[model samples]
Target chain A: MSGALLADAPGVLAALAQGASAVLLGLGLLFWFAGSWPLLGRASYLTKLHYLGISDTLGSALMLLGLLLRFQREWPLLVLALLSLVVWNTIFGYVLAACSQPRRRP
Target chain B: MSRLIVIALRMLIWLLLSADPELLNVAIGLAVSLALPLPRRVRALSPGQFWRALGESVTALPQAYSQAARLLLHRRLEESVVHDEPARVGGRASSVLVFLDVFRITLTPFTIALGLEGGGRRYRVHELVFEEKER
Candidate 1:
């Protein structure tokens, strides 16, 4: 029993990591799809934007995290990508909202 | 000085994305970074304000998630208009503040900024769930 445990320890750890990565990826896709599903409804554009933007941001972050875990050696790039995703998404959302508003005459 | 810093930071990001530390790659990254134009006004946030905003955002995350979850579980969609007053006088500073406000509010799934109203002094938000007292 002890010999078997020692032999399989590395395999067990690898399997665990793989499982975790899969779970995170699944969750990310779920968030993305669920958020987008609301867009088809009768809600207004702003409402749809709320659901889509927030979910897309969170989804991308989660997907990146999953990839980060899977590719632990490339974490610096993944972390930077995640940061850019969140920052740019929020900024773009603001831009879209600001642009959608009717311009007031001076 | 800040513009140089910005360019340097952009170069660093470019290098990271490229993942090639070769001389040619670095030169190209530097050139590209330098070519990007800087904004007319750079209102640098003081460390204190940055820290405060970071803290507030950290605390706000859970609330945002809970609200999103509630919205997801509920079948009915209710729309309501809400007004937000700018904390500063209207100008570039106020515009930056408004942008930040929109980002913060839209981070949550329940609310979106519909438009700026009342000469950009107020924001009109469309909320998924609105309470009477909030109006």
Candidate 2:
């Protein structure tokens, strides 16, 4: 068994990586569904936004990690996407929350 | 100056997107970064302040994940309250620092920074806590 595995070590490693990436992708999708399901509920807007943050930023980041693992040669681009997506979406959520507030007289 | 840091950030992003270190590519990246107009005047930002804020933002990523898990697993949410926390670096903080602060706060599932209120002395955070706390 050891000799058989040694002959195709690279192939085995690649298969394992592919399987792991698939799991990560599925998990990220699960996060998206779980987070978004609250939007239809009676929860307040800010609470909904919190759920959105988890789905949009963290879930997407997880998906990006999956892609990064599967496509090692394209790591730089994947990394750029991951960073911008996380920062921009998180900030966007804040903007939405801030705008929802009533203005105070200066 | 904070502007220098902003330019460096742009250049870093450009390099990451292009994935090329050729001389001409570097030159073009620098030129574009300079060409882009920065928002109304950046204030002086010390290196220590910049790094500390950046470090906090990085650490927030893991914390954000944990909070996301907590939020997802809990079937009921008790309430969300808007409250103020004394600012760590208050009073006209650099925009970069402000951005990092906002990013760190809003990245987590349990909290969102509503913006600095009460004359920028504190951050007005909207938070959700399901479990009761013993006072």
Candidate 3:
């Protein structure tokens, strides 16, 4: 019985990983929608930019994590993508916010 | 110290991109890392300072998720304010430290570092605060 359980371990682990990947992907989608929903409202531009950071950076990061779990063999590429995406998008948001402000020598 | 970080970063990227663990590949990666031109006038950075900044940046990841959740759940926005936050490092922070500081600040949904002000001593951050009536 112990040997049989041991033999089934990989299958069980794979199933668990698959389930976790799905959950992460679902959460990422929910975040994306929730963040983007405010864009249609009358919120100020800076507020909208704040929401954009949530959607573009955090939501996408969740999705990438999901992908990383689902496709374990592609981890290196996924990691590189995750790092660049998070850093680049966050800085891009800052640039947008900075550019929107009135020019003041600092 | 900063030069070491640049080379280390380049080597990391090269290894990630190549995904090869062979000796030849590693040798070539090291060669490429050294051959690449580093930025001019990189400010001095101590190991302690570098590690601290790195740790803070990583910590911001979980903080970002929590902040995002809060922002989404609390739909009512009280107001947007541009606040000045003093730099985390001591006087004359290096560019890498500044970049990491900016990354940590802007990663969350509530705040974005507009730019550094007061002679690179403080970050001009635009922040959003949500209404706290539900609490």
Candidate closest to the true structure, highest DockQ = 3
Report per-candidate DockQ: 0.47, 0.81, 0.85
Q: For candidate 2, give the lDDT of residue A29.
A: 95
Taking chain A of model 3 alone, its TM-score versus the true chain A equals 0.95
B15: Cα error in model 2, Å = 1.3
Docking class of 3: high
Q: How many backbone clashes does candidate 1 have?
A: 0
On residues B27-109, what C-alpha lDDT tens digit does candidate 1 reach at each position? 99988887888767775544454445556656655666666666666656655555564534354343334555666666766
Q: Which residue window of length 10 is worst by lDDT in model 3 chain B? A: B126-135
Ranking by DockQ: 3, 2, 1
Q: How far is candidate 2 from the true structure (C-alpha RMSD, Å)?
A: 2.2
lDDT of 3 by residue, A9-105 (tens): 9998999999999999999999899889999999988899899899899999999999999999999999999999999999999899888988777
Error of 3 at B89 (Å): 3.1
lDDT of 2 by residue, A1-106 (tens): 9999899999999998899899889889989999999998989999999999988999999999999889989999999999889989999999999999988554
Q: Quote the true-contact fraction of every model.
A: 0.46, 0.88, 0.90
**Which residue segments of model 3 deviate by more than 4 Å?**
B133-135
lDDT of 1 by residue, A21-66 (tens): 9998997888788888988888766777777874777777778889
